[model samples]
Target: MTDTGPRVRRIDAPRQDRQDTETYPTVARAVTAARRLVHRHPDRCRLREVGRSRAGRPLFLLSVDDGERTVLAVGGPHPNEPVGLAAAVGLAERVLELPPRPGVGWHVLLCLDPDGAALNEGWLHGPLTPARHYEHFFRPAFHEQPELLPAPDGPLAPMPESRVLTGLIDELRPVLQCSLHGVDFGGAFVQLTRPLPGLAAGFARSVARGGIPLDVDSYDAVGWDSPAPGTYVMPAPGTRWRALPDRPELSTWSYAGRYGGVTAVLEVPMWAIDAVGDARPHPDVRAAVGAAARTLHERIAELTGLLPQVPPHAGVAYGPLLRAIEFNLEVSPLLVEEWLADWSPAPLSVSRVTTARIVAQRLPLRIASMLLRLLADSGGPAADAARARARGIIAASLEGLHRLGIRWVPIGTQVGHQTRAALAAADLLLARR
Candidate 1:
């Protein structure tokens, strides 16, 4: 029921120069620019309309091929994450400058949520300040400050743009998929599919080459705090928490994983991009960031070629990795809160300890469910049974904290929510048979 055909008008041979820095005029303007770039490079680029947003905006996908392996990149699933949009647009332009290399191909789904994007267009036109922009569009925070915005009621509806992207993923089936996103106040990082030693090294090199200092701490472990250390907050009781049963199904990554390919989510801090002006700017930052993006693209291209060599059935160990991530999201809060409670003259402004305790208490059941899912997936039937036996202990610990009113969302929560929905959908898929 999604429209996966090109809807916007195409432009032919639009001028391109690094100096021709022009702020986007409007949503219309950005779409026009995207269409034009696709039109100009027809051999390498083809525009496809993927889907429509809830508000009826068309989602456009731009495909570029060098006659080899296909790589897919997408920007803006979350409306507020604009750095990816800018980077994707910039990358699209950059691709126009390079002739297709033999045996390599690329496709980009540009701004998968144009209607959501339009909502924040005012920020792009006015003061492009990061804090102000964040204050305006960050949706998760809306719960804390309900006056900020109203929650949408219904299924996890994809804006028309997102639906288009879903259709593209289902159709094109590219070997590698990257979703570009940016955090307001955080160090630069990449969210990868299981650690590939060679790929990880290349990613690190790309980050260093981009001149953005690597938060070595990020790679040290997985936790809600692991990827972006400070952004997490405690959740309230009855708050929903979920986990990825097998792998994340949001984009092509899960699909690619099924086929033994690499998929990644490249999260760049707004600070990494020179223009956002929230964090301190790095020297030669623009060049570094641009080079980093290009380098990552190149490395991904290499990985796609290498994936065929890796054994498809040789399941990689993601348990330790995901468990580390889960603890930070679900359990770390308890540890942190206990640590803070003992602090002399307790510090203000949501101490890490307090936040952790809140998450643990408020979402114990959810966390327990996540661990069970992970156990089942990892073939730890005994561990899963042991967890079931220990559920009472977990509940007691969580309930004690609940009496104190602490709460938080789990890391990789999206996977849980989507998985539930997917399971329900799968049941429906089976019933129809």
Candidate 2:
């Protein structure tokens, strides 16, 4: 693959500031900032209490309405990916500065999962290194996630947060909706609800300008059709290739489809790994997948085996860890089967191979961290023994991951890239109109 590194983009209205942001803000601080933004610009911005999180934290929507058509941006859809928290606020501030586009309005749902985000505050203010990230990591199980849950009519009760989003979708019927997300380590990539000509290239270009590598070989990207490098068409719900089914709840994009608007799931990396974008071929693709699958399976087994030993604790604090472990156990096998079934003689991209290895290395450590928390929550001889074992596992996982030499991307750079992509997407939608 021809490697033309990140290019500079010259623009006027939406530009990245020189502020070098080092650490992510905690959920409370982020919410306060959003409120302050509205308070400072009450004329252009309106902050409203849309709903409450399960934990009863009031969720607010900051609407900057100087235009007609609506563009909805949901931040912190996943508790672990807090890049969006900053991006949502930044986007609002940037848009307010520009003369409003006559055809477009911006509504940002700042910090969708505030309760879950609070759980990840340990590493939110960073020394954002790989070891710190894994040690402080937390992700809710799919069932607990608002975006992944089904509509309210199923066997499960809909998350209060999901209800807020769906209600907004129905009310605003936005022309474009962007879900902000970030990966722990990889290049930037995006998934769209439908084909939007040149939108993918626009996304790639924005991140590239930030000097963030393009994750051309994301395993999730592989499951969908790409119209451009680093951009994939989100597979329809119930896609057989998807390791986990949406089941009771439809995916956010699918649910948003009813309003005839487009959805974009934009993902940037917390840590930049150039190997994740290298398009060179791996000599033996199947062998690489097999090795990753075997390692991941072993780790899953080890973690799951310890699950029963730790007694169930009250409160939802450790619920995310348990949910995440369950999620991995359910999805890992299906993911491996799909990758192997689709195997071909043609070599796989080096980025794909690298990502496979990185995920295999990191996931176990992530689970171990969660397990440590779960173990710590329990009080017993088994729990004490499990805690010791979990620590040893985490130490080994961290040691192996550190050897990979992942480089950290400044929080400011990540926010800039996400902000640029979102603004560009809004522009494309207005242009199409």
> Candidates' TM-scores?
0.49, 0.90
Clashes of each: 20, 3
Kindly report which residue stretches of model 1 are placed more than 4 angstroms away from their true locations once superposed: 1-27, 66-68, 140-163, 219-221, 224-252, 272-433
Candidate 2 minimal-lDDT segment of 10 residues? 1-10
* lDDT, candidate 2, 1-433, per-residue tens: 1212222222223465532667676767767887787788887788888999998998889899756678999998988888888888877877787776665679999888988888888886667666676667788877788887655577887789988998999988888899999988778998888987656666766776777889887876666787778888876555564455554217666677787888888898887778787888887888887777777777777777787865655325466677787787677666566556664333789888878777777777888887776666577787788888888778877675566657778888888877777776766666653
* Each model's lDDT: 0.41, 0.76
For model 2 the TM-score comes to 0.90
Query: Could you give candidate 1's per-residue lDDT for residues 138-179 as a string of tens digits?
Result: 222211111112223524443344445556656656555666
- The TM-score leader among the candidates is 2
Clashes of 1: 20
> Which residue ranges in model 2 land beyond 4 Å of their true spot?
1-14, 151-154, 246-249, 314-317, 339-346, 377-382
Reference-based lDDT, residue 195, model 1? 38
